[model samples]
Target: MASPQIIADTEYLPTLLKLLDRAEKTIDIMEYSFAIGSATGRLNRNSAPFEIADKLIEIKESLGKKIRIRLYIEGYRETASRNMVTAEYLKEHGIEVVYGATHAKGFCIDNKFLLFGSTNLTQQSILKNHETNLLLNDKKAIAGFNKYFEFHWKGGGHGGVILPPPMIADGVFKDVLVDMIDRAEKSLNFSIYFFHISEIEKAFIRAHKRKVKITGLIHHHDAFALSYVRRTRGTAERMNDAGIKDLHYGPGTLFTHSKFLVMDNKEVMLGTGNWLHEDVEVHPQLYIHLKDPTLATNLTKHLQKTLRTVKRHRKEYTDSISI
Candidate 1:
């Protein structure tokens, strides 16, 4: 399958809205944050043209019982948390709302189209912040994610289930990195805005020893870069000693706030998860693993272009890598 087209800046709205408008059976949304008001001051009202809240309401009314809507929002009531009113309104029309304490975000529409992205479907993310999402039409892939969704939906309280221990416990960051490294076959290409986890450092070192080609991007502006520079220097030294190739760095402003990984050109993982101790250890983070090269290759090209323009400050990670 060819990779889905890359849409960035303000160009994503039309295609995304079209997908929404074409939905026939159901819409399942798991969001970390959701809002309807102007999260960005620039907008007189909400930033996105169509309110997600309103869309659900309209679908319920027009489609009647044929439309099944499921919404999962994370966390309890907090001052600045995403509003639950959206869920409440949906319930009045017979839509179900599931509240979760987990922080990951994913959604499936009609069990065919899947969207996994960095944004939380909130006003701030859709209209104010930079965000990216993947659209997959693969049946197996959709089923895999839907299974995850169903697991949580059924296990979550009221309308869903909370995850059990180990999966829900702290310190899964190391395990996740190890899983990624274990899954890497020929190469590992990862870009992180911030990376300071000690265990993850070890995982990469271990992969390098096993002959996995590991390339990485670390933002210069992040505090973790200073620490990573110091820690990865030894890893690079070891790789150099073993005749392994040096790691490459993607180019961008001092700030590159994307966490993505491409493995063996066969899979791509993108999302809100950063390679940081905090993200790995404490923060609720989510990521989508895309197994199609069409999606992986395009993202590879973009990262390569960005990496090319970077200026090297450290000798361990490439001074510059062009995507």
Candidate 2:
């Protein structure tokens, strides 16, 4: 089996664009958030997110019916306007665009390459944020991702009804995560964007009580400026107080937008949703659990390396807390 390659930072966007440029047969995309233009506060002028959308449009226009392009996006009405406009534009140009509560960030190119991870197809994710993705040239891995996409493409519904599989479905995923954490024998490593679920927090506390080495890396910025930061900080502090000593916050320069967990260097879980209750209950998300030791070890090492770059928060909570 060909091993999957981990791509991070600036390499992700260019690599995705190159794959899209080279695709000949089909392009399947699943994203939680996708925008056409540059994101606000973007430093670079040459935006890769817009370039990717433009590339897909160009492919559809140039190939006409020769190429097949399908995009499955999250269609919650609150954020529906932008995605709907993009969907309409793509549909008008002959691309198949389906909107649902999709939170899976991935792409399958001509059945030859599969890329999936924490990176959303947005300007912020591609150019400005810190993200991690796995690119697989292995046929077996590609087949698995293809199966997942096909299952959702046919059975998925708008809102929160799109069920990919029983193991990773809504409510089930939360149980699976808690079970995974509870069953950890040696270590638990996690890199998450947002986390507010109490069950998950209690599971980690339990693991720590069992003498399991628990470590985590979370984003410093609260997605929204209002209560999001407060909630995130509260969760982090609570976890720290509960005995998960190694939890560290990522720097504000690049958002740590990865959602993954490694248990005992033997199993790994990667997915789209934050560890929040609403994400699992109301949003369409994908969670892939694997027992590959190689992948798990690599992800664990990556997490440790990323943690080294950021400052560790003091083990003290202040009354005047601000994220």
Candidate 3:
């Protein structure tokens, strides 16, 4: 089995670009959103989004018909024009571009390597947001994702809907998560953004009652706070009240946009989707559950280190919960 490595924050863009530059035979990209502009924010250093796009274009132009490049993008109604423009730009540059309703983000290079996670190919996602991605060199894992890519490439469902197989389908996400939490023997750690699902909160409460150590890092920026203050704050208060006292708000520098769970350092669930009830019901998300001890240990250490840097909200339970 090839060892998995976790790539987080702004590192994903540059690493992905390097892979794109080195791709020998084929490059398959699946992203939920795409924009043509520069990446901005603290970590990105004003990097241009076209830096990656242009590199792919350059490879296609230089390699001529020897290389195969296909980009599958989400066809969101609100951003149809932008997707169309980006698709046209790539199509003009010898790359095949297709639009579909997908919330999956991943890249497959030469059918030997794969990178997939919650990060989208946009300015905010690449440069500004706190994203989590896993790079795998394992042939089996690569082949599995390649199969998924091929399924979507051939247009599996109506209106270009790409569905994961039954084992890891969307319908099982909540059930799998709750089961993982329920089966935790030692610890449950999660770092997430926009976590408003009540079932997950109840799971945490139940785990706390089971004497399992639970820790969470939730997003607390103005962008999320403005729209989801009640949900975010209320969840934190409820968790704290339930005795999971290690809950902390995200650091100011990064957006804490990762959605992952580490159960007892034995299994890791990494993927897209904000753990929102509506997202589970409607959005097309993808996640992989791995039983690699090395990855679980590394991710656990990383989450603990990140938790140390975050600010914990001191709660004073009065007549009502604070938002």
Native-to-model Cα distance after best TM-score fit, residue 278 in candidate 3, in Å: 2.2
lDDT of predicted model 1 = 0.58
Model 3 C-alpha lDDT per residue in residues 1-323, reported as the tens digit of each score: 65588988788887888888788899998777766732221233244456677888999989988999999887765555556666777898999988776677888899877898878777777887777899988676666666666666677532233333321434357777888999998999888887888888899999999999987778766543465646777888888887889777775446778889999998988887778875677766677778877898898888876665442322321112122
Error of 2 at 207 (Å): 1.2
The residue-level lDDT of candidate 2 at 39 comes to 30
Q: What's the TM-score of every candidate structure?
A: 0.67, 0.84, 0.86
lDDT of 2 by residue, 1-323 (tens): 65567777678977988888888889999877776632332233255666777789998888888899999877774556666656666787788987776777888999988788888766778877768888877665566566667766886542434343322544456777898899999999998887888999899999999999988887765336446556677888998887677877776556789888889998877777788877777766666666778988998888877765454433332222122
Q: Which stretches of candidate 1 lie over 4 Å from their true place?
A: 1-12, 38-44, 77-80, 89-94, 127-130, 157-176, 179-187, 205-257, 276-291, 305-323
Comparing 1 with 2 on lDDT, the higher-scoring candidate is: 2
Predicted structure 3: lDDT: 0.74
Query: After aligning candidate 1 to the native by TM-score, how far in Å is the CA of 200 from where it should be?
Result: 1.9
Please report the candidate that would top TM-score against the real structure.
3
Single out the weakest 10-residue window by summed lDDT for candidate 3: 313-322
Cα shift from native, residue 125, model 1 (Å): 2.6
